[model samples]
Target: MKNLKLKAARAAKDLSQQDLAAAVGVTRQTIGMIEAGNYNPSLQLCIAICKTLGMTLDQLFWEE
Candidate 1:
């Protein structure tokens, strides 16, 4: 499934995919793929992304 929550949270924080990826030490394409559900990030990567966005793992990566 698409990670719309991640996309929305990134948007709410005024972060482009590039910005978020830079903060999380990944490529912009990685961020895009995550949002598009084409990539399944590692736990460390997920934590990095959550930290950069000021969100918890559940808030960003959990499937409801």
Candidate 2:
């Protein structure tokens, strides 16, 4: 499934995929893949993304 919640949260923070990726030490394509559900990030990467987005793991990564 698509990670629309992550996309929306990123948008709400005015963060482009590049910006969020740089903040989390990944490539923009990595971020895109995550939102596209083509990649399952490592726990460390997930935590980094959550921190950069000011969100919890559940708020961003949970399927619900």
Off by more than 4 A, model 1 = none
For candidate 1, the per-residue lDDT at 50 reads 94
lDDT of 1 by residue, 6-62 (tens): 999999999999999999999999999999999999999999999999999999988
Q: For residues 1-64, write the lDDT of model 2, one tens digit per residue.
A: 8999999999999999999999999999999999999999999999999999999999999985
lDDT of 1: 0.96
lDDT to native, each model = 0.96, 0.96
Clashes of 1: 0
